[model samples]
Target: MTRIAINGFGRIGRSILRMLLTSRAEDGFELVAINDIAPLQSCAYLFAYDSVFGPYPGDVRHEDGAIIVDGRRIPFHSVADIREVDLQGVDVLLECTGAEGGRAEVERGLEAGAGSVLISGPSDVADMTVVLGANEADLGAHRVVSNASCTTNALAPLLALLDSHWGVESGHMTTVHCYTGSQPTVDKPKANLVRSRAAALSMVPTTTSAARLIGAVLPGLDGRIEARAVRVPSASVSCIDLTVQTRKPARVDEVNAVLEQAAESPVFGWITLPLVSTDLRMRSESIVMSGRETSVSVGGLLRVFGWYDNEWGFSNRMLDVAGLMAAR
Candidate 1:
């Protein structure tokens, strides 16, 4: 079994742990340790009873400095530095802290004895940024790697397939994302004026790095994609509104067919029925293409919609990448 350790027991971190506990029988991942600055009690409570995912299905309790799940004792660490944690037998350290400490943070995990470090978010300094179905083939024998961001993961796969099949001339993507922990519940002080206001009270327009990061993952479409984000009031699930002008004119049926065929794999999903954001919660696929919403303009301007559980799907992809790292 691949022994796994998690840093930053927040939404992503906790989601990974929940996935492991629920799918341990089939997945070869073992949760050995967790590192977070939060108190053990708080981690336990939050893990056991998540507002978005609801309560965990099995036994959950905090004993000593660890969170025990399903009778398995996993050590938890509250540390100021990543180097302080013992990763002796850890095959992969899922760095979900959302820290931009860059190279220094990755080296600390390796220096502390982790075999490999998989960052949960985008990292410019990491050896490679993998977006599972999009560019996981680029994964190599690197000590540190990045899984990119949730938005990037959702966007890359569709972009890859479309660009490969019909040829992407240029594209603009707008993600309707849910409010995250980064935003405050009520009006508060923040660097961005829009984000400083209430998080769950309005749809705040903001910028996203997914478009810029797309160039890093799929260099072929580097300068062709433009992207933005609007943070909605919902607590979970986000959908991408992508409009791309294809090099060749294709009908809506053709576009939907392309994604439909790709959906044969577990990495992608296809939905012909109308569904809400809540229906997408806990969805394991990186991106669920809304075939029902696919449309093409007279000028061959292709538009596609895809839904994703930003946290759940990305957390699952982290494990998928971790599995590859462990095998390597």
Candidate 2:
């Protein structure tokens, strides 16, 4: 079995942990260890709040700093000193921490003899930044990989489609994303300049590194894309709006057909819904991929809209990519 370790226990980290607990048996992977700066006793409460495995999924218990699920006891430890733990047998170390701390976590995993370190969030030190199916092949020679942000992952397939079929001259994207744990529920001053404001009652304009990371995944798109982000009040789902300048103007149907084909492509197969929307009621939260695919559409002026459950959707893709890498 593939032994895995997780760092951090926040929204994405906790979701990744739950994903592993529920998916490992089927995927031939196992959660060997989990670390966070927070106390282990809080894990039970965190797990209870997780939408994926709310309030303990099946025969789960917390005892002696470990979580027992279906007779498997997964140990939890403090991340303050990651070197204290023996990760020699861990096949993959998932850094879902989303902190600048990720760089240190990857270093520790390498020192502990992990074959690969897969970061669930963006990181500056990763050997390569990937958006799963988009540039997964780039991970072949890398020991440490960073799965670009959820917004980037959700938009990659769509951008690839446009570039392949209509051909993109330049593009701009804005992700209306749900508020994360890092954001405050009420207005408060934070260390970061932009995120210091409250997320509950405001739309926070922020810059995104997704565009640069997207360029890494699709080298053909270098210097052709720009991105921005907005932190919204919703807790789970997020949406992306992209405006592209095509090399030559094409009919709306032609654009939709291209997206539909890319959605069916094995490499970019996550795009499930392709349509044109004139309804103002089309909401970011209402969009979801019921099947193993993504939703996409062509709006006026070569614009497109895509939606995703930032946490669940991206976490699912992370595991899928990890599975493929492990097999190789």
Candidate 3:
């Protein structure tokens, strides 16, 4: 089994642990150690009961310096610096901390004994950024890599598929995203005024890197796509509203048919039935396209709607990338 060490036991970190425990036999990955600033008891409690994912199905307890899940004890270290953790035999150190100085931390992980590093979010310093199906081949001999952002993971595959079948001219995406830890619960001071309001009370407009990063994955379409975000009150799940002008005209039926064939993969899903955010809670597909919501104009303009569990889907991709690295 591949030995993995988590650098941050936050939302993504805990989600990864849950996935490993639930599918350990099939996935062939092991949790060797976890490093977080929070105390072990706090981590254990949060893992046992999550607001979004609900209570973990397995028994969770903490003793000595490890969190025991289903009788398996994984070492837990509470530390501000990852260099202090013993990552001697770790195959990959998952960097989910969203640290601003992530480039430096990647080096620290390499020096601290980890064989490689996989960042949960985008990083300029990463050897490369991969969005699973869209750009998995781009992953090479690099030791440090990024899984990109959740929106990128959700949008890139769809765009790539569209562009492949009918060349894309230009596009714009607006992500109706759920509030995250970055925003405040109540009105407070923040660098971004729109995000300062209560997260559960307002739909705040902001910027996104997904549109910008698509070019990195599919260079032929770079400089042709733009994206923005609206932070909604929900705690999980996000929607992507994308409009693209294709070189070839397509009918609505044809577009939906293509997506339907692509469904059930780790990177994409096709939903024939109507559904809401809460219904998507633990659905593993990175992005699910609603066939009922697709529309295409005679003039080669196409609109697509997609939904994703921001944390769950992205966590799955992180592990998938880690496994890819291990296999190499």
Best by lDDT: 1
Clashing pairs in 2: 270-293, 270-294, 271-294, 272-294
For each of the candidates, give the backbone clash count.
0, 4, 0
Compared with the true structure, the alpha-carbon lDDT of candidate 3 equals 0.89
TM-score of each: 0.97, 0.84, 0.97
Q: What is the lDDT of residue 66 in candidate 1?
A: 83
The whole-model lDDT of each prediction reads: 0.91, 0.70, 0.89
* Model 3 residue pairs with clashes: none
**Model 2, span 161-250: residue lDDT tens:** 677777888889998887887788776787776798878778888877787888788889888899999998766677788888888676
For model 1, how does the per-residue alpha-carbon lDDT over 145-221 read when each residue is reduced to its tens digit?
99999999999998999988899999999999999888999999999999898998999999887978999999999
RMSD of each: 1.1, 4.8, 1.2
Per-residue lDDT, model 3, residue 211, is 68
lDDT of 1: 0.91
Residue 300's lDDT within candidate 3 is 64
lDDT, model 3, position 27: 84
